[model samples]
Target chain A: MTAKPKLAVWKFSSCDGCQLSLLDCEDELLAVAGAVEIAYFLEASRAVTSGPYDLSLVEGSITTPHDAERIRKVRRQSRTLITIGACATAGGIQALKNFANVQSFIRSVYPHPEFIDTLATSTAIKDHVPVDFELRGCPISKHQLLELVSAVLNLRKPVIPTASQCLECKRAGTVCVMVASGTPCLGPVTQAGCGNLCPAHDRGCYGCFGPAEAPNTASLAQHLAVLGQSRRDIELAFRSFNANAEAFRREGNAHERE
Target chain B: MASKTPAPADRAGVIARAALDELVALLAGRGYRVIGPQLRDGAIVYDDLARADQLPAGWIDQQEGGSYRLVRGPDAALFGHVVGPHSWKRFLYPPAQKLWQAERSAGGFTVTTAAEPEPPLAFLGVRACELHAIAIQDRVFGVESGDFTDSGYAARRQAALLVAVNCGRAAGTCFCVSMQTGPKVTEDLAYDLVLTELLDDRRHDFLVTAGTARGAELLAGLPQRPASAADLVEAEAASARAAVQSRAMVPGVADLLRQNLEHRHWDAVAERCLGCANCTMVCPTCFCSTVEDVTDLSGDHAERWRKWDSCYTLEFSYIHGGGVRRETAARYRQWITHKLSSWHDQFGSSGCTGCGRCITWCPVGIDITAEARAIRDAEGS
Candidate 1:
């Protein structure tokens, strides 16, 4: 019998919700453990193993110089590197710093600003090294994580849709909260993966999954304007989860305050 | 299971305004979960109907791009407005469904296919456009195709009892007249039962017509009177007004869209498109899906599931290396071309039923009819 493939999990700058999602896979964690040897996961296991790992699941955005160097080393050791959640795929919510002065932020937050070692911009893993796959979500769905691992082991292509969240809402039979109630929703331009949780609760989408394939953010922004949403509101909507993502970044930039 | 009873001759008649409660009771008595349009969360949506009082009796909805509002009508007329955001597809083709499950034992893996649950459903207030949408899906999922049959969809569709409502008024976004699917219920596309709501100064009643044997049997149980020529004329007028009220028309749009694949309008539309897939989701006939595998942490149990997907996403066309439709313009082109043009090649008809849900529900208010017209008119110029 062949030895199991080694799996490694890494973190950078994030809330750790995406990694937590993996641990939250209450039923499927054991099956995943059986399929692959957990070589290095600081969040889950204390027993660590050094790489050349077969697969590395990277979470969080690269915010500091040390993280940028660490990601390169991780890529060198791993045969297939997959980015999980919005942070690793797009710069995530921390990417809101991409629009502001990092130095000023550090000074305001910490008493010793000189001690803070950081980069001006938070960026995705793909910005530094090549990624085999990128799973898009604020807190990545546990089911998708299982599919990714299963596909890798089976030597087949993973099937993760790049469709908008609107399809989920439609299929779930949730009424259009934006159209029906004049709520400003980002679902039209956001990717599907969160199972349409917000719309089901009668709330508009916060765009946690980031920009779907080629989002028509301009049109949605204009529609929001017609719905009585201020320019600031439209900008904030695009700047939420995947703020540094190209499509959302461009749309948010368009509505930036003078 | 409810017995399929045959009906006596002569089932066409008028149901009294007060006897609407009896219709609800009759459907419930047959063991069907009665579903109809009710005002909820500020919009008319399909939900479980316990009694006739649950219907949107004195309400009418105004629909347009980026707008929907419920207003009190002149009288308590059920089924006064056209279609809403929710459709019968929700019941027939659910968003997410489990296909099978597997358990890893010491010996090996044990796989078990999910059993199909057949729950009897009676759909009230189904519009002609919605009926056409259901028929379109039937062609895709039904056994007659012999290609790939969705057993879940087939079972749910077969178990459903359709009660159609002839549109008395059309929303501003409606264009079923051009699609030739609605504004009027035709005999060939037979529903189990059809109700044409008639509200006038003199009386409020429904001119009911049974299109199938099942409908005739159901109608035989309710109180009614023979439809007079005046009543038939009144019903015809209502449908005519709806047809005339339709502003957006796409008479030969399929050929126009097919020929203009490289039109610059795609780029212009793409610029405004969020690639959010609101159009595809709201569209009653758009039926793309993706499959997912989920396993429990124990390494012992796993399940395969299918959920709704859209072409607007890059991953829908993704292979091993990358996606075929990487750009937003390409995705938008694929969606519109598939719905209007290529759907005819795959299925024998256009995928769109002209319910205008896509137009009304779109966050961007991208009018499909306007986009089609722009492409056609540009070629003319």
Candidate 2:
């Protein structure tokens, strides 16, 4: 009597981390299958169910002309579109390629540059098509993924946290690695969901959860400088996986180049 | 379900040793496993408790900023140490958890969720601060927005029997009193039973109170004496002493940090920070992480996993073509503000617990308390 909800998983240019998160739900994988119909997921299954899907999870950045055109098709096929991970929500690590010349990159990587079919810049899913919900994380947290699925099934807004990672650290009773060890951490400004993993292993945060609501990144950067990190060091830190993100890129560019 | 509080007088002057044996038997009888601190690998760590003899007695530990050492106590007393590096988190979150598994099948492909194990447990000697930490986690993983959702965690939490122990001696890194969470268990309803250790020159007894029917049942099976008014006075005095001895100070800190969100102090601290994610690792509450996938040698099957990640990592903040907090300065600024100021707005509480672990464990020794103090002084100028 009840129709099974149709689900689709889409990918662009990425490391496949976010889509992998869905499959990573090893314990809940079968339950998820029973809850919904898998309309499309190139990574998980060979069978493809044509859309007007109930739910669509989009991953990776739009890095080529074909990718830009493909996202529009994905947008048309899905009723509710959710972008997963840094590549889909933001442009992702590959967005760092946007800083340099794409033509040169293609030429260097490939002997024949003319064979390359790529765009000038790497961009997020929102840059190409409308996104209903944007889940923040390099590889989105599986717990959050489960919540999104549940919220979607219930037809309610997901109650994902908008606060910073610092709250999570405090809740976990971890000593501030930054304050205690002068190990520069990004938890104060980064969003929560990673389950305080880095701090648990006696390491500082590296901003994998992206920016929290209304982050004060400028102030934290100044504090790190006072603790004795160099400007080049600071710049390098920000320019890592998320270097292509607008906020981090802007700040990193302002720093003195070593 | 919460339990009813039993009469305090009915559960007084109970020797701690006898109570331990009784608790172990009660847990074993109830079809629950018991785990507590034990001496292993030259350190006190969490392990299974087979009987009362497995407990660490007459062993006290000396702890200071950035250091911990086990030392012999004047008397052979179990449960003398404040806490170890490992908490209850290891059992719940686990260092590694397989999210799902994928196998190539005749019908194209199949993905299966990992089998979940619901293990019932009884934690012995849970301190007030640790209890607070668990409560905080309850708010996180128990909700829809939280990064982790484990029915197993919920089931274990629901079935576990909490026996809260009030801290009588302060570890050098402890500042729970400053955080206003310990020395005396204010949220007595959170636990099924509470024990206030009564130590005098001639006697060592614990004042026990049953919080639920389960606690009452456990108490009825034990031998106890009526608590005197003097015993209550002594307990209050012990708590007061801890509050005074607290070393952390961040007066009006959350509000102050919120008011000066654009201050230049954070930039200074950024220079020394490595963004290595050590702080988040050591922090009891930092929960940000990443997901990973690995394939079998034949490449026919693949499995996915969630690994811990940090905001300090450059790729974590990427958006569009770049990161929002580009400099370590901005990254550090974002981190401190969220902890001391923004966290209050979101969680209705300051993120920092005044635990000096961050200061002591930091490889470079960046003090959070001092950071707030500097901010306060800067605002004044």
Pick by DockQ: which candidate is best?
A: 1
TM-score of each: 0.88, 0.57
Query: lDDT tens string, model 1, A135-199?
Result: 98888988788777877876766756666788778777788888888888888888877889899
Model 2 docking grade: incorrect
Q: After superposition, how far is residue A39 of candidate 1 from its true place, in Å?
A: 4.5
lDDT of 2 by residue, B67-167 (tens): 45667866655666667655665555554567899998886778998867655777777777777776666555663244656665566677777777776
Instruction: Count residue pairs with overlapping backbones in model 2.
Output: 117
Error of 1 at A70 (Å): 3.3
**Candidate 1 segments exceeding 4 Å error:** A1-7, A29-39, A49-55, A76-80, A150-156, B1-11, B99-112, B142-155, B200-203, B291-306, B317-327, B341-347
